[model samples]
Structures are given as C-alpha cells and as structure tokens.
Target chain A: MNRQVLLFYPLLGMILLGLFIGGLAYGAVPIPLDHVVDILLGKGSDKIAWQNIVLQSRLPQAITALLAGASLATSGLLLQTLFRNPLAGPSILGISDGANLGVAAIMLYFGGTLGQFADWPISGYMAVILAAFAGACAILGLIIYFSAKVKNNVMLLIIGIMIGYLASSVISILNYYSSTDRVHAFVMWGLGNFSGVSLEQLPFLGSCTLAGLLLAILLIKPLNALLLGEMYAANLGIHIKRTRILILLCTGILTATTTAFCGPISFIGLAVPHIARLMLGSSNHKMLVPVTVLTGSCIALLCNMLMVVPGSNMILPLNAVTPMLGAPVIIYVIVNRKNIQYFN
Target chain B: MAMKQTSVIKTSDLSIGYTLKGGRKKCVHDALNLSLYPGEVTCLLGLNGAGKSTLLRTLCGFQPPLGGKIELMGKPLSSYSQGSFSRMVGVVLTEKTNAGGITVYELASLGRHPYTGFFGQLRQEDHRIIEESLIAAGIAHKAHNYVSELSDGERQKAMIAKALAQQCPIILLDEPTAFLDVTSRIETMVLLHKLAVEQQKAILLSTHDLDLAIQLGDCLWLQEKGRPMACGTPEDLILGGAFETFFSKEGIVFDPGTGKLHTEAPTVPVGVEGDLTTSYWVGNALIRNGFKPSLVSEEYVSVCCNAPNDLRILFPVGDMRIAESIAEMVSIIVHKS
Candidate 1:
C-alpha cells in the first residue's frame, strides 16, 4: 500500500468523526456539542425525549447515510467495472427504478394501507425490504439475461435505460389511478429521505448493506479482471456467467436496501466511483473499490449534513442534493470525453 | 520436426462450431481435427470468413466444440476448471479490451490470478514473473503508464507480456499482427518465434500476412473453403505447389523465380553478348524495353548486330557502336554475309 493512502485513513477517520458529531449537533433541535458527546457516552441529562431524539432519530439517520453512501458507491463501482462503462451506476440497470416501481405499486395500487401494515408480525420492514429486493432483482435479472445475449456494452446500457423508462412509465400509471392520499405518500417517498428508516429497522438495513458490501469485496478479483473486458476476464479464469450473476445480486441487494430505507436516492451509486477514480487516478479495483466505498460514505455523510444546513428550517431532499454533486462529475466526464480513455 | 515431448493441445476429430438458438438452430462449422505441438509456432492462414477465430476460440476452450474432443495436455479441455484452463492456455485476443486507467504492471499482475490465493494477492515469485515478462516483451519502461497511453503496438506487446506472465504451456493469439505497422509486425513475429523456441511453449496464431507466416512459423495450417490442411516447411509447401492450388486465379501466377505472384509477360530480343557482369544489367534494361537477352559467342554478336533486328544498341559506349536492327543492321549483315 502507498504511504499516501495510509495517511488518508486518519484524515478520513477525523472527517467521519466530525461528520458524526456535526450530524448529531446540527439537527432541528440543535443540541450543544458537549451534550451531544454526553448523550453518545450515556452521560447526558436523564430526559426521555432527549435520549429518544438523539439515539433514535439523529443517530439512525446519520448511520443510514453512512451505510447508504458506502453501499451505493460500491454498487456503482461494481456496475461500472462489470459493464465497462464509466457512466454506469446502480440505476443504469434500472434497479432503483424497479425499487421505485415496487414502492409505487404498494403505495398507489395497494393503497397507503400497505405501509401502515408495519405492525403486522410477519410483514413489517421485512415485507417492504422483500418487495424492494424482488423489484430490484427483477430488473437485475433482466439486465443479466440481456447482458449475456448482448455483447455490446453501449447497447446493454441503452437497454437498461429503456428498462428504466418502462418502470417509470408503470409507476406513472399507478400514480395516475391512485387516490390523493396514496399519491401524497408516494410523492413523499419519491422525495428521498435517509431519515425515513427507524432505529428498529436499522439492524436489518445495516446487515443487508454489509452483506452486499462483502459480496462486492468478494468480487474484487473478477472485477479487476473485468476492467479488461468480459473475454479477458474469462481468459483470466473468471467464470463470466457466475461473476455476472454475483454482481447483479450484489447490485440488487445494495440498491434494494437503500431504496427500501431511503426511497431510491439517485446518483450516489453512479457518481461516487468516478469521484474515487478521479481522486486515485487508477482503476486497479484493489485500490479503487475500497477508496470508492470510503468516498461514498464521505459523500453521503456530506450530503446528509448539507440537507439540513445549520440555521435553516427548510431541509432539501437527499435526491436533489446528490444530483448537485453527481451530475457535474458526469458532465465533466462527457465534456472531456476524448481526454478520458475508456478502454485500451 | 516432431519432438518426443508431450503435446500441449490435441484435437481429435474435432468439429468446432457455434450453435445459434433461434426458431431453428444451425452450427457454424463442421468437425475437424487439429493438433498443436509443444515448442512450435503454428500459423493459421485463411480468408476473412473462414472461421479461423471461431476455431481458435473453440480450441482455447472458450466455446465447447460442436462435436469431437479437445484435449489440453492429455486432459479433456472441458474437464478442467476455468482457473486450471487459464493456467494451461493463455490467449491474446484481437480486440483491444477495456484497459482504461489500469497500468501495465497492474494489467500484467492480473495474469497471476490463477496462482494467487483468495484475494488475488501477488507473491514475490509472481512479481518476479511479471518483471521478467515485462522485460521479455520489452515494455518494462511502460510499467507505470496506463495501458490506454500505449500505442497499438505497445499495447499488443503489453498484452503478450500479460500472457507470458501467465506462463501457460499453450498461447493462442488471434491475428496478433492485424493492426500493427510493418516493423511491429516483424517484431511481434520474432517475439512469438523466440517464445516458442526459448520458452518451449506451443504458440498458435492466426494471421493474414502469409509472407511473414511462411518466413517465421514452424508449421502452417491453411484453411481453404471448409477443409484445413497442415503443411511442414514453407519450402515443402511451395515445392508441392500447395500455394498455387490455394491462391490460383486469372492473371495471377505464383512465380517460382521470386517466390511471389507475378504477371506473365512476352519475350523480348535475344542473342546479345557481353561480359556476364555487365550483361546482367544490360539484360534488365533490355527486359524493361520489352526485349529479352540471350547469350551468344562474341563473334555471334557482330553477326546478329549486322542482321535485321527490332532495336538493339551496343554497350561500352562512345567508341563501340554496334548496330542490330532492321534498317542499318539488315544492309550490313546482307553485305557481310
């Protein structure tokens, strides 16, 4: 490992600490930094409301941001490598759109009654997560099937976009026929909120995202080989079919978990890897994967912080904030297209 | 020359083809048997649509043979795992892959994946192999440069180096020199020849440059229409008139004299005499002027010069002027004779 990368660990650590502290102290109820530290250390005032607000509300939201960032970023890196497309991200395969469609179907067609069924013993967060997983997997499965048939990367990308359009169209129809209350609930979910996931649901979200991350790590070797191309990866002894399936699964899980919790936050999975690649100046995957994960976490944390700027009551939607960060990197990559070499 | 060593690749009545699944199914090519020997360079020669690449892919075990069997080092190609198969045969494909922002060193290290542990960490021996392969391919200096920065020739070298680092017994290259310049083509051929001779690896390559193929390869696999014929030395093939049969067409005769195709031309003047050395140049000049040169005695030159001829001029310039044409020589020859 390079000494510079080793040096980055402490800096990233400090930034994470600062972000965590800032996330706890800078919310709507603006607790003092000392009180925030005391609450974290279990030494704050013995007030139920304060404890609930700090532990349940802000901490879960911040952790959600951190995990979502890492998961989306890792998902983006995997997709980019697997597809051999710089612009490829989680949504490129329509996984997020698939998740959106699932949420829309449940909220609109099944009515807002579906979300209120969280109290049902078997169908609470598990139901929503499963729904999101199935939806994302459906799109991922289609993408994988098409990927096997269509050897061209750009053509596969177009197909993925078309799939996204189809899913969006389906969601639009559901929204059109639904009642006003259902539409209101679906629209709010569409706005994208990291704070929507409760503390009780955090464990499930965290475990699923972690599993996706582990799978992504397991794919590092094949991903590195894939950076050459599928044929080259096959030449390097990677089972292309199995590797593609694993990638789709990982992408499905990561995107599904994020969508289930945060409601299909866009651009993080598509942009963070590019940012990491630009920062690292290499695509070895051994380095790029880890850096992208950390950078995703950092970016997500930053965006979460930005969503609730201090002294401002108006909080921006996380989706709106992500595009503000992600779109410029994409446009820069496009505008300076010739300067960037995609394949050797 | 057949060595007594173990064969790295053997095809037994192998009919290689791709099965296209649609409303109705079809196979690309019928079964064919081919064997690749250790420590030899086998050049596959064929026209554009002769299924040469398809054959190579099938032989490398990327695609299963439509019929028959392919054995790698006496084991069925399909029997080995992908990692073991990769370790047995390294392939350099014709298309440039997605190398993008990867350095030459990183790309070369990927060749060692079959040997690495779970995380694909490089051992010291792996590093040594990578360094040696880089030096062998003459791309050591470009180790840190992104593969995207290398020229087509350099990139090809790097790719070959990656295969070398893999240290496979069989190396299959598809049109290795297809996009290279003349110098790069020669260098790549020479490199492959060296690899076969020194590393003792069996190298199978497909190429359109028949001349270089004939010059460098130890054997030739010529695909004509649906049939494939293997030949020994290029000289033997030529002597056997195999090339004539393969490339025969109107206005194109394979010239035995130059070992190349040349158009047949009409004969020129004859019976001109001079010193053998100067006569060579004089003969070339005569041929350019649509005249043929023939050797005769020094006395016959004067007789022929006096006789009527088309058009002839004497050599050795100013002092010596010999006439050999219908106008002046005819009168002189009639009087002298």
Candidate 2:
C-alpha cells in the first residue's frame, strides 16, 4: 500500500484503542478509566457489579460493533460488484428487510406462544434467529433466481426495491393485528441495538460472518471481471449464474445475522462501499475489499462511541447515529454524479 | 505463411434462423454450404436485414443453426468447450461498451484470459502478444489512455486489437465499418486485409460498404434475403450480376462503363470517334459538366458549349476547331470520319 494506508493503520489502531476504553468507561453506570483497564487486565477491585458491566456487557457490545461493521461493509462491496451498480447493497436487495419481516412476524404474532415454549424445546432467541435466517435465505434465493433472467443491473435494482416494499407491507399487516404487549416488544427491537447479542452467541455469529466474508474474497476474480459487464465477464470464462448465486448467498448470511442480533441498520451497507472507493481511488477488489472492511469497522466503532457520549445520561440509538455518518456520503455521490465513475 | 492448408471453417447444409416454440421457423438462410480457407479475407455483403450478422454469429457458435453442422479446423464447433472455442476463434461484436475508467491496455489484456490461469495471471507470452497486437493495430501509443477518451475510429481499432491479441486462427467481425467515416472505413478494411494476408489467419467480416469490401476481400459471400451466393473475385460478382440483382433498386443503377454507380442518364454525342479509349475520358468530362454520356453509331462531335453565348465548338484529332456554325460542325465531322 501506499503511505496513506500505512498511516491509516496506526491511526485506526489508536482510534480502536480509544473506542474500547470509551466502551468500557461510559455505559449506564460509568467506570473510571483506571478501573476499566484494571478490569480488562483481570486486576480490578472487589466491585462485582463493575466487573459484570465491564466484562460481560460492554466488551461484547464493542466487539459486535466492529464485526458487524466489517461484515456489512464487505457485503455491500460484493453486492455492488456482482450487480455492477454503485447503489446496490445488502439492504437494497431485500435481505435485511426480509430478516426484519421475519422478526416482526415472530415478535408480533407469535411472541407470547414462543416465550411459553421457551422451556419446552427451543428458546425464543433461537426461534428468532432461525426465522430470520429462513427469511433471508428465501429472499436471497428469489434474487438469485431472478438474476439469471434479468440481464440489466438497473432492472434488478428496481426488482429488489419492490421486494423490500412487499415485505414491509406484510410486516405492517402483522403489526396491525397483534396485541399491544407483542407490538411493544417488536417496536423495541425495531429501534436497533448492538447490546442484545450476548457473548455466548458471538462465536457462532462471528464465524458465520467470517465464512460469508471468505466466500466474498474467493469471488474477487469474477467480481473484477463483472465490473465491465456480464457479457464481458462471461467472455472471460466466468460462470455468471453460479457467481451471482454465490454472491446472493453470502450477502444473505451477513445481512440476516446482523439483523437477527441488531435490528435493521440502514445506510452502512449502502454507503460504505462508495466510501471505500472514494478513499482508495481504485475499483480493484483485491484492495477495495480489505479497505471497506477496515473502514467499516472504524465507522462502526465511532458510531458506538458516539452512542454513549461522555457525561450523558441518555444513550443514543445505533440507527440514529448511522444516518448522520452515511447520509452525507450519499448526498456527496449525488452532487458529484458527473465525476464518479462506477463500474470500471 | 502457411499455404494449401485445410479449411478453417466448414458449414454443411446449414439452415440457420430463429426457431419459435410452435414449430415455426423464420429461417434467415437455408441449405447453405461453404468453407472458409485459412489466410483469406472473406467478406459477407448484403442489404439491410439480409441475415449477414446471423450467419456470422451461427458460425462463431453464439447461435445454433436450425439444421446443420459446423466444423472448425477438423473438430465440430459444438464439441469444443467454450474456453477452447473462444481460444480458437476471436469475435469483435458490434455492441458498444458503456463502462467508464477502463484503460485500453486493461481492456486488451482481457483477451489473454483463455491462456492465463484461473486467477488471470498474465504470462510473458501474453504480454508479448498484447504488445504486438497493439502495435499491429497502430494503437500502441494509446495503451495508457482511457477507452472513453478515444474517438470512435480509435476505439474501433482498439477493439480489433483486443481480438488480435487473442491470437485466434479465425476472426469474425460484424459491421466493423458501420459508423466510421470514409477514411476510417478504408483504413480499417486495409488493416483487416493485412491481418488476413500477413498473419495467415482466416478473417470473415460483415459490412454494407460494398465498394471497400469488393476492393479488399479475397472472396465475397453475397446474401440477398434467402438467396446465398459466393464468388472468388469482386469482378466475378460484378460480371455475374450479383451486385445488380441485390443493390440495384429504383432510381439507382450500377454503370459498367465507369465501374462506378450513377443515378442519372448518360449523355455523350453519338458516334464521336478519336480512339475509343480517349473518347471514354471525353465522355466522363461531359458527364461531369452535367451532360449525360450516351453511346451512339453516329460519328459526330457536337459540343453545345453553353458557357458564353451558346457558341457551338467542334473538335477533331485531325486538327479542326471549327466554331459557331452548323457548316463548320459538318466540315469537322467529315474530316474526323
């Protein structure tokens, strides 16, 4: 890399360290910086509540932010390449909305019954995760099936938006009939949070994200070929059908896992790839993929830090913080539309 | 160059067209048989919508023939894998690329994918071929420039260079001069001819520029709707009335006198004599001055020179520049005969 990327690494390192410290220091119950470091090193005082807050609660939240950021950003990059559209992303494909619809149906219509059966066979969290996973896979399968039929990228984008609207309408009908308590629970989940995913579930969630990211990396060659166009990619001997299916599957897994744990976080998946391209000034996936991953992690960590600002009693929602960072980039792309070269 | 080689492409009983689901077929051409020899430029000529592009596509294995067999070299066209088939035959399509920020060299290097490994690593031979192909197409100086910055003619050359870098034995181009100006059209035709002759490759190109095609091609594959014809030379097609039958519509005629097409009547004095060769040039001069040239049995030089005062001047090679009177015209004609 270049000297700028080299400098960015150390700067990102320091920012990551600061965010970790801030995550431990500024939760609902504030811990001193020295005590936070002590708790991290396993040398804290005899305050059991501080240990619980620092070790169990804050650390997993911070790691989840980092992983979710990187996973969603990489997912955005791969989708953009596969579809050859600058505006394509995980949420735009209806994968995230599919997961949201799954969660809404479960929480609004089947919330009380699922909790009643929590001790019998499956837990409520497991049921929600399974429902989200199935919903995500269903939409991904549909997108892949249609990708073979639709040769134009812009048409596929319009189809994806239509799917999202269809899923949203279904969720609205479910919300209208549900009881007040269940609706309240669904509404709380819709607010979006990184604190819901416990440390015990992090390994499974993290590995699934990693697996999807690895598949995306394996597809870099075909992605580069696809940057020109599908016909050009086909001329280069890439099996276009199989490659598009793989991209859908990977984007589905990443989007579903993040939406299962945290509610639908918008704009990161749609905006981060463009940010990475602007920063790197290259469309080559070999460099773009890693840069998007890191930039995503940094942005997510920054958002997490801003959520629990210093000397604040009320915590900001994660979704509320993302638009502030993502909307400007979208506007910048629109304003400089004449200058931005997308596919190639 | 290789000589007396086997046919590079062979089509037997080819009935190619689009087949609908209900057993109805809109056949472009039916029951055709032809062989393309190596080191020859075969030009396919036709009026609009005469299935010239369809034939090229069918031969390249992009579209399947309704009832026929196509063999490249010795093996069947369908028997080869897509990768191997692409390696054997390069194609320059008429489709325009809308991609931006792609460099000319980067676009040309995509042709090396067949020889490159799975990850598309460019080998030394691949680099050499790319450089040589760029030089051959006269776009080596534009390797670093973006494709979007190049003019239409330069971009057309770059596209041809990309196909050349594929190093295929057979090349097919569809309407290569469709949007080019006159000079660019001639230059591209000359480049294709050089590739066919110097590289010893089989080249087939479809074009509506019949004048350039007839001048440059070694063989002509003439198609008129369902009727297909082939001739060895341009003169053969002209003599066989293929050009007249296909292109001569109302108000247009192919004149054999000048070997150039014309849209008006010929007007020259009937039976004017002074070595028929020199009289041909005199007739051309009359036609240039808005007077038609017509062949007649009479032996008289009538010049109604309308430039000044309707002053009629008669000229004979025997030294008679008689002027201004019917008596002088008769005297000049008597001396010339």
Candidate 3:
C-alpha cells in the first residue's frame, strides 16, 4: 500500500466516527453532543427522555446504518468487479425487489400475518424478514441458474434485470389490491428508513451482514483476478463459475437482509464503491474492498444524519434524501467517466 | 524438426468442434495429428471459420476436444487440475477485456496467483520475478503506469510480462498480434520468438499475418474448412506444394521463388537482364502491368546500372521504348500493349 492509501484508512475512520456520533446527537429531539457521548458511555443523562433517546432509539439506528452501508457497498463492489460493470449493485440482480415483493405479499395480502398459513404464530417483523429472505433467495437462485447457462456477463445482467422487473410488477399489483391503510403502511416501508430495525432485531441483521462481509473479504483474491475478465482469471486458476456463484450468493444475503429490516435503501451500493474507487484511484480489490467498506459506513451515517434537520424536527424520507445525495455523485462519475479509471 | 527431443505437446487423431445441446456434433476437423517442440514457434494459419481459434482454445484446455487424446509433457492434458494446468501453460488473447485501473506491477503480480497464498500477498522472491518479467517484456519502464493509461501495444506487453511471470513452459496466444500495428506486430512476434529460443518455451500462436508467419514460424499448422490440418516446417510446406494448394484463390498466387504473395497473373512473357537489384523491381513493374518478366527468356526488358534511372522496354513486334521513370514506363506499356 502507498502512503496515500494508508492515510485514507485513518481519514475514513475519523469521518465514520464523526458521522456516527452526529447520528446519535442529532434526532427529532436534539440532545447535546457531550450528553449523547456520556449517555453512550453508560453515564445516564439527567433527563430520562434524553437517555432513552440516545441509548434506546438512536443507537440501534446508527449501528444498523453502519452495518447496512458496509454490506450493501461490499455487495456493489463484488458485483461491479464480477460483471466488470460500473452500474451493478446489490439491487441490480433484483434480490432487493424480490424482498420487496415478499413483503408486499405478506403486508398487503395477509395483513402482515403468518398465523393464517401455519400453525406456529409469528410477529409482523419476523414474517417480513423471513418472507423477504425467501423471496430474495428465490430470485437469487433464478439468477444463478441463468448465470450458469449464460456465458456472457452483460447477458446475465440483462436477465437479472428482467427478473427484477418481474418481481417489481408483482409488488405493484399487490399494492393496488390492498386496503388504503395497508397500502399506506406498505408505501411507508417502501419509502425506506434507517431506524426500522429495532435494538432487538439488530442481532440477526448484524450477524448476517458481518458474515457476508467476511465472505466478501475472503473473496478479495478471486475478485481481483476477475477484474481482468474470465479468460485471464481462468488462466490464473480461478474457477469462474464458482467465483461468480459465491459473489451472487453474498450480494443476495446482504441485499435481502438489509432490505428486509431497513427497507430498500438505494444507491449506497451503487455509489459508495465508486466513491472509494475515485478516492483510491485503483481497483485491486485488496485495498478497494476494505476502503469500500469504510467509505460505505461513512456515507450511510452521513445520509442518516442528513435526514434530521438541525433547528427543527422536519425529518426527510430516506429515499428522498438518498437520491439527493447520491444522484449527483453518480452523474459526476458518468460525465467524467473517461477521466476516471475503472476496468482497463 | 528435431525428433530426438521429447515433444512439449502432442495430439493424435484429435477432433475439434462444438457439440450442440441435443447431442448434435458440429465437427470442424478430425484425424488431426500435431506436435509442438520446445524452443520453437509454431504458427497456426487458416481462413475465417476454419477453427483456428477453436484449435488453439482446445490445445490450451479452454475448450473440450471432440475426440482423441492430447499429451502435455508426457502427461494427459485432462489429468492436470486447473492449478497444475495453469502452472504449465500461459495464455494471451487479442480480445479486449476489462482494463481496470491497476498498475503494471500489480497486473504482472496476478501471474503469481496460482502459486500465492490465500490473500495473494507477494513475497520478496515473487517481486524479483515480476521485475524480471517486466524487463523481459520490454515494459519495465512503465511498470508503475496504470494499465488503462498504456497504449494498446504497451498493454499487450504488460499482459505478456504477466504471462512471463507465470514461468509456464508453454504459452498459447490466440491472435496475439492481430490488433497490433505493423511495427508492434513484428516486435511482438520477434519477442515471442526470442522467448521460445532463449527460454526453451514452446510457443503456439494463431495469426493472419502470413508474411511474418512464413519468416519466423519454425512450424506452421494450415487449416481449411472441414479438412485435416497440415503441419510441417514452412520450407517443407512450400516445397511439397502445400502452400499453393492451401491458399489458392483467383488472381492470387504464392511465388516460391520470390517467397512473396502476388495478386497478378501476367500473360505475355518478357525477359529481364542487366542490373540484378534494379531488375527485381523491373520484374515487379512488368508483372503488375500484365507482362511476365523472366531472367532467362527469349524476350527481354533491359535495365542498366550505368543509367539506373533509365529502363528500356522491348515489344514483341520489334518496337523499343525508353522511359525516364517506372510510371512513364508503365504508361508506355499500357498504351502500346
């Protein structure tokens, strides 16, 4: 690693830490910065409301944002590397849309109840989570099957988009048939937010994201080899089919779990990897992967913080705030794509 | 050509082509016998759709063969695992791939992937080998440059350097020089030839540049649609009348005497005499202008070294004409004849 790359890690660390702290301090009820830190350190604030706000509400949201950011960004990076396409992300394969479809089926059709289908009763959140996982995996399996049959990357990508479109149309149909209140609830979920996953739900989301991220880290060598294209990567002893399957599987797990809990947060996966690539100016995957992880966390936290207004409590929808932050970066990257180095 | 030394790779009765999904076989060629020797460059030449690329891909284990056997260094080609197979063969392709923003050193280091550990961190010894490979490929000066920043020729050299870093005994290239400029094409061929001779690495390449292949290839594999491949030394193929039959087309012939391809078949024979060097060019002008020039024929077009700029054209009807330049000479011959 060069001096610049080495220096970038610490800078990213500082930014992530700063944004995380800001996420805790700035909320609907604005708590002082020091009190938020003290409350986090277990020294309770004088106001129990402040204590509950910091330790209970803001803490889970911040951690969820950080983990989701890393997972989504890593997925995006793997897909980008695998397909050699700049635009690939966790949602590109329609895994997130599949999750959305599952949630739609449960929330809209069954009134968010699994009790009618099975003997064992399940909560609304668990039902959504399980259904989303099942939906995402179903689509992931379909994509993997096509991936095995289709030799070309661009063709596989087109097939994935076709599958995504299929899932999305189903979601739209479900939404149209549901009651007004159920439809409103479904639309709220679709709007997306970082605070949806509770303190209790963090364990499942956290472990899965960490495992996916670990698998991604282990995949650095193969991912680097893949940057040269399939022929050379095969010549370099990489099993192209196996590597591709693993990448899709990892991206599926991350996108499904995050979309299930936190809803379908957009563009972090699509934009953060490029942000790291733009900063690092290299795509070796060794540095790009870890840097992508950190950069992802920082940006997600930054976006989460941007949701809360400083003087007042007019919090914006995550979907609205996300596109505002991410679209310009994407446009800049696109317009100046020639100046940026990606695939050789 | 030397049979005593063991062959680097040999195939017997090998058939190559694609097998469709419904068990329908699309056989390109069958009953093929070919051998590649260490310290030699073997060039495969064929018209489009003749399965030259398929053959190259098959030999390197990229495509499965339709029938028969291939032995690599006395071992069955299929027996080696991907890891072991990669150690023995290096492949370079002409197709443009994802040119990622990686430095030349990092790109070259990827050649060590088969040997590297899980994380693929390079050791000091691997670094030394990478440096040597860069030097050998003649891109050592641009070792730090991004792969996307390099020109096509430089990028090709970078890829060759990575293959060199593999330390593989055999290198298979599919039209390695197909996309290069003339100078770079010759440079790449010469570089491969040098590697073959100096490193004793068996090199096999398929190319469309017949002139370079004829000059530099130690052995040539000639393929035509649905026909068995013809393999031999370039000299033997030329002398045994294979070149004439293999590449025969209308208004085109391979001249064995001049060792060049010509696109003209002149009718009336005209003999050439005097300055030997200038006479060669005079003959070229005559053939192109619909007159066959001969060194020892009844009719003659005389060129004198004393007056090198002067050319005298003798017509069959006892008419003689002297022209100042080749263009003027061609004009006079075109109008009168």
Candidate of highest lDDT: 3
Across residues B1-337, which tens digit of lDDT does each residue of candidate 1 receive? 5445667787787776667766343445565667788788989987787778888988877777878888888989889988888898998997647786888998899999888987899989999999999998889999988888998888888999999999998999999999899999999999999989998989999998888988998888877665556556677777888777665656555544235553444253345544444444444444444444565434333222323333344332222345544445334433433
- lDDT of candidate 2 at residue A324, scale 0 to 100: 92
| Candidate 3 docking DockQ | 0.68
Pairwise TM-score winner, candidates 1 and 3: 3
Global fold similarity of model 3 (TM-score): 0.94
Candidate 2 chain A vs. true chain A: TM-score?
Answer: 0.89
Docking class of 3: medium
In model 1, pairs of residues that clash are B14-B32, B15-B31, B268-B292, B269-B292
Return the interface RMSD of the candidates, in order shown, one decimal each: 1.7, 2.9, 1.4
Docking quality level of the chain pair in candidate 1 = medium
- Chain B TM-score for the candidates in order: 0.77, 0.81, 0.92
Which candidate wins on TM-score? 3
Scanning candidate 1 chain A in windows of ten residues, the lowest lDDT window is A113-122
Q: Per-residue error at A138 for model 2, in Å?
A: 3.9
Clashing pairs in 3: A343-B99, A343-B100, A344-B98, A344-B99, A344-B100
- Candidate 1 error regions (>4 Å): A45-52, A113-122, A341-344, B2-6, B22-31, B249-256, B259-337
**Ordering by TM-score:** 3, 1, 2
